[model samples]
Target chain A: MELSLCNISYSVPGKRILQNINESFKPGRFYGIIGPNGVGKSTLLKLLSGIEKPEQGEARLDGRDISAIPRKELARDVAVLQQGGLAPVGFTVKEIVRMGRFPYQSWLGGESVDPEPLINEALESMGLTGLQHRRLHQLSGGERQRVALAKLMVQQPRILLLDEPTTYLDIGYQLQLLDNVRAWQKSEGLLVIAVLHDLNLAAMYADELIALHEGKVLARGVPDAVLQPDLIETMYETRATIIRHPELDVPQVMLAPGVIKSNGLLSRSLEAHVRRL
Target chain B: MLLLAVSITASLSMGSAGLSFADVWGILLHQLPWMPDADTIWSRGEVAIVMQVRLSRVLLAVLVGACLALAGTGFQGVLRNPLADPYTLGVASGSSVGAAFLILFGFQLAIGVWTIPIVAFLTGIATLLGVIALSRSNGVMQIQTLILSGVILQSFLGAFVSLMVSMSEGVVNQILFWIMGSLAMRGWEHVTMLLPFLLIGLVILIAYSGTMNLFVLGERQAAHLGVRVERTKLIVLVASTLLTAAAVSVSGVIGFVGLVVPHMIRLIVGPDYRYITPLSAIAGGIFLLWADTLARTALSPKELPLGVVTALVGAPFFAYLLHRRMKDQRGEE
Candidate 1:
C-alpha cells in the first residue's frame, strides 16, 4: 500500500505546526523524518497514521482519503507506536504484545486473531522470547523498546509510524532495532516511517530521508541527496563535514567546530571545536 | 464452581433465625418428605422471617455486591486507575442527596415509597452526564479534570444530604438507618426491584469487557486501536453509575465492596478486564454474603450495619494492599 500526504497543514490555537506538507511513502522502504526538537516531525507522522486529522489537507491510502475510512479499517492499514506507549503496571511483555490484537477482535462473540503464533513470532523476531513473561517494569530501557517494537510487529500493519523509537537505546541497540525493522520490512513488504534525531544513523539506515526544520520540509530525497554537508550545516546552524562510509559508501556527518568569536575577537578555537567534533 | 456452590448453600442456610442445612434444603425442595421439616418447629413467625425475609436479604446482598464490584472493575479499567471505585466519581453522593431530598420533601406531595429510588436513579444519571459534559473538551475527557469535578460534586451533594438529614423532624431514625445501611427490612420486593437493573448493568459491563482491556492502556492508545474512546467512556460511566444508584437506593450506602473487590481481582489476575470483571462479580457476591452472615451471627439479636461490616473487613485489607503496592514500587526502583 502507498501512503501519501497531500498538501497537509496543521495548526494549534496559537501557532501553525505543519504547513502544506506534501509527502508519499512507498512500501518495502525504511523512511526517516529528521528534525530538531519541536519541529512537528511527530505531528506529521500522526497525520499520516490517521491518529490526528490534518487541517486543510488529506492523507490518502491508495486513492481513497484515509479520513473517510472507518477507524477500524484505518487501524488495520496503519499502526502507530508513540514514544509514550508505556505498559501499565504488572503488564507482562507477552500481554502487551497480545494487545495488538485489539483492532482485530470484535466487541462480542468474535474470535480474536490467533495470537499465540503471532506473539511467538514477534518475540522471537525481536529477540525477546526469553523475556516474554517478564513484567515491563523489570526490563531494561533497550529491552522495553524491543517489547514495544514486538507489539507493533504483532500488529502487522501495512504502514508503521514510529515516533522516536530509539530515544532511550544505546548505539548497539539502535542499530539492532533498525536492522530488525529492515528485515521485517523486506519480508512483510511494510512501509516503515520513523522520526529519528541522529542524522548519521538516519543516513545509514533510511532508504529515504525527509528533513524538517521549523515545521516545514527543508529537504527530502535519498540519503546522498538530502544529507549534504551544506544542507546539514544550514538546517542545524552548525558547521559539519560529510564523508562517505568506508564499507557501505553512505554519507556520514562529522561536525566541524572551526572557530569561535568571543567579544568580537577571533581566537584559535579549533582545539575546543575538535574536542567537541 | 464448587466454592461458589458451597457459598450459595451457606448463604441459604445461615441467618438470624437459624435453619439447619437440612431444613433449608427442605424449604428449597418443598416436595422432599425425608428432609427435616420446619413448620412451627422453629416458630411460624421465625420461619417466615428466615425463609421470606433473610433469604431475600442474602440474595439482594449478593446481587448488590456483584453489581458494585462489576461497576467498580469497569470504572477502574476505563479510567486506567486502580484507585477508582464505582462511587469515586460522585455518583453515590449525588444519588444520596437525591434520595434524601425525595424522602424528606416528597412526603408532602403524597409520593409513594418508590419515589425516592426513582429520583435517586435519575439524579445519579443526570449528575454523571453533567460531569461528563463539563469535563469533556474537543472530544477528549481529561482524567484529572473529570476526577476533580467528581470530587467537587461529591462535596456539594454530601452537604446537601447532611442539611436534609439535619432539618428533617421525626425522621431522624429513618435517616440514620438509611445512611448507616442495613439489611433489616430488605425483602423480596427490594430484591425484585434491583434484579433487572443488576442484570442489565452486568450484561453491559460484560459486553464491553474487550474495550475495557484496551481502555486500561490509556485513551489515546485505545482510540488509536479504534476503540471509540469517548463513547465507551460515556457508556461505562452511565452504566456503572446506574448500577451504583440502583444498589444504593435499595441498600443505602453500602461502601467498600465496590472499591476493594476489583482491586483484589486485578492484583491476582492482572489487568485483563475480561477475567477481572467476572471474577470480581463472583468474589464480590461471596464476600458480601459472608459479611452479611457475620453481621447477623457476630452478635445475637443485635445486627451490625452492613456498611460497618464491609468497612471493618475492607479497610485493613485495602491498607495492606496499598502497603504491598508501595513496597513493590520501591522494589522496582
Candidate 2:
C-alpha cells in the first residue's frame, strides 16, 4: 500500500497551520514525522489519515483519492490511533481492540470469528493476553498504548497512522512499543507512520523520517540522512550532536541544553541560527 | 422472562375485581358455557371490570413503560450521558402544555376525547425538532447544550401548564389527573395510539445499537469509525421523542422509569445497547406492571398515581446509585 499527500494545506480562520505539503509512505517501512510544538505535525498526520480533509489539496491511497472512498471503506484500508485514545468507561482491553473490526462486522451478524483469532494473536504479540479482560482505565500509560497498538493490529489495515502514541510512556515501554510495531510491520509488510517527539526514538525505530515545520515538509528521507545534528538543531532551535548506534549504525541524537545568559543573549543566537538555517 | 410472565399474570389477576389465576385463564379462554357464567356465581360486573377494564390498563402500563424506557435508553446513548431520560429533551413538558391548552380551551370547541392527545403528540414532536434545530452548529448537536435547552424549555412549558391549570375552573381535576399520570381509564384506543410509535421507535433504536456503541466513544471517534454522527443523532432524537410523545399521549406523564431503568440495566449488564435496549424493554415492562399493580392494591380501591409510584421507587434508587458512583470515583482517585 502507498499513501501520497499532494499539495496539502490547512488553515484555521486567519492563520494557516499547514502550507502546501507533499509526502508519501510505502509498505514494509516505519516512518516517523517529527517537529516542535505547534508545527502542524499532528495536523499533517490527520490529513494523511483522513481525519481532517486538506483545505487545498488531497491525499491518495493507491490511485484513489481518500476523500472519494466511503469512510467505512477507508477505515478498512487505514487505521489511525490518535494520541491518548480515550477509553469510555467500562470498555475492556479486548472490547477496545474489537472496535477495530467495526468496518468488517454487520449489525446483526456479530463479530467475526476470524477477527477473534486476529485479536487474540495481537494480544499475545503485545503480551496483553493476561490483561485482555482488564478495563482500559486500569492499565498504565504504556499498557494502554499497547492496547491501542493491539487495536490497530486487529484492524489489519494496509496503512497505520499513530499520533504521539508513546508520549506518556517511560523509555522502556516506549522502546517496547516501537519494537512491537516494527516486528509487526516486518511480518505483515504493513505501512507504519508515527508522529514522535523523541528524535532519538524516531532515529532508532524509523526506517525513514519526515520533519514537518509549520505544516510543510522540511526534510524527508532515510532516517540516517534526515536526523543530522544540523537539521535537528535548526528545526528545534537547540544544539545537538548526531552519532551512530554502536550495533545498528542508526543516527542517535544527543542534545546540549541552551547556554543561559542574561539580556536574552542565548535565545537571540538560537533565533539567528534558525533563521540562517 | 419468567418473572415478566409471572408479573403479567399477577397484574391481570390481582385487581379490585378479583379473579384467581384459573379464573383469569378461563375468562381468557372463553370457556364459560352460559352467558356471564351464572350472573350470581361470577358477577358480570366483576368479569367486565377485570377482563375488559383492568386488562387493557395493564397492557397500557406495560406498553407505556417499554416506550419510555426504550426512549430513555436511546436518549442516554445519543447524549452520551447516563443522566439523560426520555423527557430530558422537554417532550413531556411540551406535551403537557399542549394537553393543558386543549383542556382549557379546545375541549369546549367540540373535538373528540382523542384530539388532545394527538395535539399533544404533535406539539411534543415540534418542540423536540425546535430543540434539535437550535442546538445544531456546524452540523453537530452539542449534547450538553441540547440538555440545557431542554431543561429551560421544560421549565417554561411547566409554567404555562400551571398557569392554564390555575385559570381553569371546571377542568381542575381533569388537568390534575393528567399531570399526575394514570393507567386508570386507558383502553384499546390508548393501546392502538401508542403501539405504532413504540414499534417504530424500538426498530429505529435497535437498528442504531452498533452506532450507539461507537457513539459512547465520543462523536469524533464515531465519525472516524464511519458513523454518520449527526444523522444518527437526529434519527435517534426524533424517534425517541416520538416514543415519549406517544407514551405521554396515552398515559399523561410517567416519570423516572425512563431515567432509572436504562441506568440500572447498564449496571447489571455492561453498557452495550444491544443488551440494554431489549433488557430495558422487558425490565421496564415488568417494573411498571408491578408498580401499577401496587398502585391498584397498595391503596385498595383508591389508586395512587402511577407517576408517584415510580418516583417513590426510582428516586431513592437513583440517589443511592449516584452516591455509590461518586464514592467509586473517590476511591479510584
Candidate 3:
C-alpha cells in the first residue's frame, strides 16, 4: 500500500498550519517527520490518518482519495498512534487492545474473524502479555505506549501514522519503542510515518527523514543527506553541529549552547571560525 | 434479576395498605386470564387497590428507573464525563414548567387523559432542541457549549415555573410536588407512555454501545477508530433525550437515579457500555422500586418525594466517590 499527500493545505481561521504540502510514503519503510513545535507536523499526520481533511488537495491511499473511503474501511488499512497517548480510565490492556477490532465488529459485537488470537499475539509481541489484565493507569508511561502499540498491532493496519509516540519516555524507553516500531514495520512490510522531536533519534531510526518547517517540507531525503548542520540550523533557528555516529555511521546533531544568547560575549564568539582539519 | 424480583415482591406486599405476601400473590395470580374470576377471594375494593393502583405504580417505577439509567449511561458516554446524567440537558426544568403551566392556570385538556405528561414530553423535546440549537457553532455542538446552554435553559425555565406557581395559591404545593418529583398516582397510563420510548431508546443505545466505548476515548480517537463521530453523537443525544423526557414526563423529574445508578453499575462491571446499559436498566429498576417502597411506607401514611429519597442516598455516595478520586490523585502524584 502507498500513502501520499497531494498539495495538501490546512488552516484554522487565522492561521495556516500546512501549505500545499506534498509527500508520499512507501510500504516497508520508516519515515520520520521532524520540525520545531507548531509546524503542522501533527496536522499532516492527521490528514494522512483521515482524521482531518485537508482544506485543499487530497490524501490518497493507492491513488484513491482517502475521503472517498468509508471510515471503517479506511480504518482497516490505516492506524494512528497519537501523542501523549490516551488517559487510561480503567480500561484493561486486553480490553483496550481488543477495541482495535472495532472496525471489524458488528452492532451486536460480532467479528468476522476471532480477535483473541490476534490480541494475544499482539500482546506477546509488544511484551504486554504480563500487563494485559492490568488497568492502563496502573502502568508506567512506556508500558502504556506499548499497550497502545499493541492495540495498533491488533488492528493490523498496513499504514501506521505515529504522532510523537515517544514524547514522555526516558532515553531507554525511547529506543525500546522505536526499536519495536522499526522491527514491526520491517516484519509486517508496513509504511510507518512518525513525527519525531529529537533529530538524532529520528536520523537513527527512520530510513528517510522529511524535515518540516513553517508548514512546508524543508527537505526530504536519506538521514545522511537531510541531516546537514546548515539545514538543521536554518530550520530550527539555532546553531548546531552534525557528526557521524562512531558505530552506525549516521549523522548525529549536537546543538551549540547559548545560541539564544542575551550577552555580548557569545555573540562575539559566533564570529570566530575554526579551519577545517 | 433476583434483586428486582425481591424488590417487586416487597413493593407489592408492603405499601400503606397492609397486605400479606399470600394475599398479594393471590391477587396477582387471580388477575391472570387463566385464573377463574369466581375463585377470587379479595373484595372489589381490595382488588382495585392492590392490582390496578399498587401494581401499576411498581411497573411505572421500574420503567422510569430503567429509562433514566439508560439515558444516564448514554449521556455519560457521549459527554465522556462521569458526572453527566439524563437531566444534564435541563429536560426536567422544562417539564416542570410545562406541568406548572397546566396546574397554575387551570388549563383545559384537549388531549383527553394524556394532558400533563404529553405537554411535559413535548416541552422537554422542545427544550432539548433549543439547547442543541444554542450549542451548535458552525454545525458542531461542542461539549462545553451544550453543557452551558443546558444550565442557562434550566435557570430560564425554572424562573417561569416559579413565577407561574407564585400566581396561584391552591396549586403551589401541587406544582412544588411536581418539581420535587413523585411517582404517586402513576398507573398504566404512565407506564404505556414510557414503554415505547424506553424500548426504542434502549435498543438504539445498546446497539451503539461499542461506539460509545470508543467515544470514551475522546472524539478524535473514536473517529479514527471507524466511528462516524458526529453522526453517532447526534444519534446518542437524540435517543438519550427521548429516554429522559419520557421518564420525566411520567415521574415529574426524579433526580439522582440517573446520576447515581450508572455510576454504581460502572463500579461493579467495568466502563463497557454493552454491559453497563442493560445491567443499569435492571439495577436501576431494583433501586427505584426499593426507593419508592421506602418513600410511601417509611412513615406509613405520609409519603416522601421520590427525589428526596434518591438525593438523600445518592448525594453522600457521590461525595464519597469524589473524595476517593481526589485521594487517589494525591496518591498518584
Candidate 4:
C-alpha cells in the first residue's frame, strides 16, 4: 500500500464522523468506499487526500506522515476530485487542464518544456480533444466531468481520491465515468480510492469494496466477499439481494423493498427500520 | 495606450487658459532634457501650467485609476465575489476617519504636502490590519469573516468620521469636497507617494495570477492542486489592500472605477486574471484620464468631482455590458 490510514478518527464539534478507521491503499488498484448518507465515507476520503487532518491518527504516504509533507510536494503525487467537479470558471478546457500543472509550474506560469503536448495527451485520453477551446460553462454535465478528469490526468498524480464524482450524473454517465477512471487507473498504476454511493457501480468497478457503517468499517475485501446481501442489509438497514454478475463474477446489489419484515410490509419511516437494525 | 496618451494631451490643453495641442506637446517636449530647447518658444507661465500642474494631475489620475482597478480585480478573484471592489475592505471609511481627524483637530504636521495623505495612508493600513486580525483565526482568513469585519469597521469608523465632521469649524466644506474625491491640483508629491505601491502591488499580483486561476475551484480544490491556500490568500489580500490604500490616500475616495473597470476588462478578455490584471491597469488609466478630463472641462472654471464623473460614465456603461452579456447568453442558448 502506498497510502495507509492508521487508526484515523475525525470529529467536528459534537458530531463524531469517522472513528478508528484503518485501511491501506496499494498502487494499481481501485478501492471503492461504500456507505449510506453521513456514514463518513467522504470524510475518510478527505483525510486520505490530505484535505483534512484526522483527529486521533495519521495518514502516511510511503513511510512519512502526510501532514509532515509540504502541500506542493504532496500535490505532485496525490490529486482529489470533489463532487460537482470544478465550478464553471470562465476558462477554456485547455486552460483549466493546464492549471493542473500548478505544482510543477513557476510563479509566472512557465514550465520547463511546452506543456501543450502533455495537456493534449490528457485531453485526448479524456475524450475532450474537440472541446479544448470550449469554455467550462458551455459544457454538459458529462463533458464537464471529463474536463475535470483531464485536469487531474495533467497533474500526473500517483494517488487519486474521488469524492462522489458521479453523484449528479445519470446512469449512463456514471458507468462511462467509472469506465474511464478504471482504464486510467490501470494504465497509470494509480492507487484510486473513491467514495461511491451506487453500490452496484462500486462493486462493478472497484477491485476492493469497503463497507462503512456509522463511522466504522463493517467489511473490507474483494467485491465478491464484501458485497454480500447480509453485509449490505446490516450496514444500511435496508433489504438488499446480492448476486454475482454472470460474466464479471462481481456481486451486484438489488434493492428488495419490504422484504426485511416477515409480513412483507414496508415501513413508512426509515428511522424506525434503522432502529430495528 | 494611444487613447490614454491622447486623453492626457487633450487634458493638458483644456484648462482655463487656452493652450493648443501643439503648445501642450511643445511645452511637454521642452521639459525633457534630451529634447531641443523649446522652452523659450512657449511662455514660462504656460510651461509651468502644462508641465508641473496639469501633467502631475493627469499622471495622478492614471496612477490612482490603475491601482484601484488592479486591486479590484485581485479582490474579486480572491473573494470569489463579482461585486467586490477595492473599497470593500473599509479602506475608504478608514481614510475618511483619518482626514476627518486631521481637519477637526487642526493637526498640521511639518510634512507639508504629505500631511493629509500620509495620515490617511497610515490609518488605511491600520484598518486593513485590524480587519485581517479580527477575521483570521489560526492564521486562516475566512472570506465571509474578512468581509464582515470590513463592514463592521466601516460602520465603526464612519461614526467617528461623523463625530469629527460635526466638531469641525473651518475646513468643513474642504473636507467634504476631499471626501467626495478629486484629482484637482494634484502635483508630483501625490505621484511619488502612489508610484512605489502601485509598482510593488502589480508585481505581486501578476506573479500570483496563475494561482488565482485555481481559486475559481474554491479554496479546498485550490489547495488540492498544490496552492498553499492560506499563504496565497494572505499575500493577495495584503498586496491588493496596499494598492487600494495607496489609491484612496492620494485620491480621497474614487468609486466605480475599481468596481466596474475589472468587469469591463473581463468582458473583453475573459476572466483570466493573468490577462485581466494587466489589461485592467491599462484600460483603467485611460478611463480615469478621460473621465478626469471631462470632469475638468465639463464645467470649465468650476470642476466636478472625479468620483461623480466615473459613476456617471461607469453606471451606464456597466448596464450596457450586462445587457449585452445577457443577450450573448440568450444567443448561445
Overall local distance difference test of candidate 1:
0.80
Which stretches of model 1 miss by more than 4 angstroms?
A109-115, A256-277, B31-43, B106-109, B169-173, B321-333
User: Which tens-of-lDDT digit does each residue in B1-333 have in candidate 3?
Assistant: 988887887789887678888888888877788897723577887788777889899988999999999999999999887778898888888888898898887772656657888899889999999999999976788988898899899999999988988898877888888878889877787888789998999899989998898887788878778888878888998999999888988888888998888998887787888899999999888888888888988987889999999888778976787677668667876
lDDT of 1 by residue, A4-79 (tens): 9899899889777899988888888889999778779988887777767898889899978887887777778788
RMSD of each: 5.2, 3.9, 4.6, 2.9
lDDT for position B93 in model 1: 85
Q: What is the lDDT of residue A26 in candidate 1?
A: 87
Clashing pairs in 4: none
TM-score ranking, high to low: 4, 3, 1, 2
Candidate ordering by lDDT (highest first)? 4, 3, 2, 1
C-alpha TM-score for every candidate: 0.90, 0.89, 0.94, 0.94
Every model: iRMSD: 1.8, 1.8, 0.9, 1.0
- Stretches of model 3 off by over 4 angstroms after superposition: A259-277, B108-110, B317-333
DockQ, each predicted model: 0.45, 0.46, 0.67, 0.77
**TM-score leader:** 4
Q: Which is superior by DockQ, 1 or 3?
A: 3
In candidate 2 the C-alpha lDDT for residue B264 amounts to: 83
Name the better of 1 and 2 by DockQ: 2
lDDT of 3 by residue, A1-277 (tens): 9999999999999788899988889999999999889889998988898877899999999999998899999989999988887786688999999998988888788988888999999999998888888888788988988988888888889999999988999999999989999889989899999999999999899999999987889999999999988898767767788888999979999877753457656654463222111
What RMSD value applies to candidate 2? 3.9
Per-residue lDDT of candidate 2, residues B115-207 (tens digit): 878888888988898787778776768888999988888898899999999999988888878877888866888988888888898888898
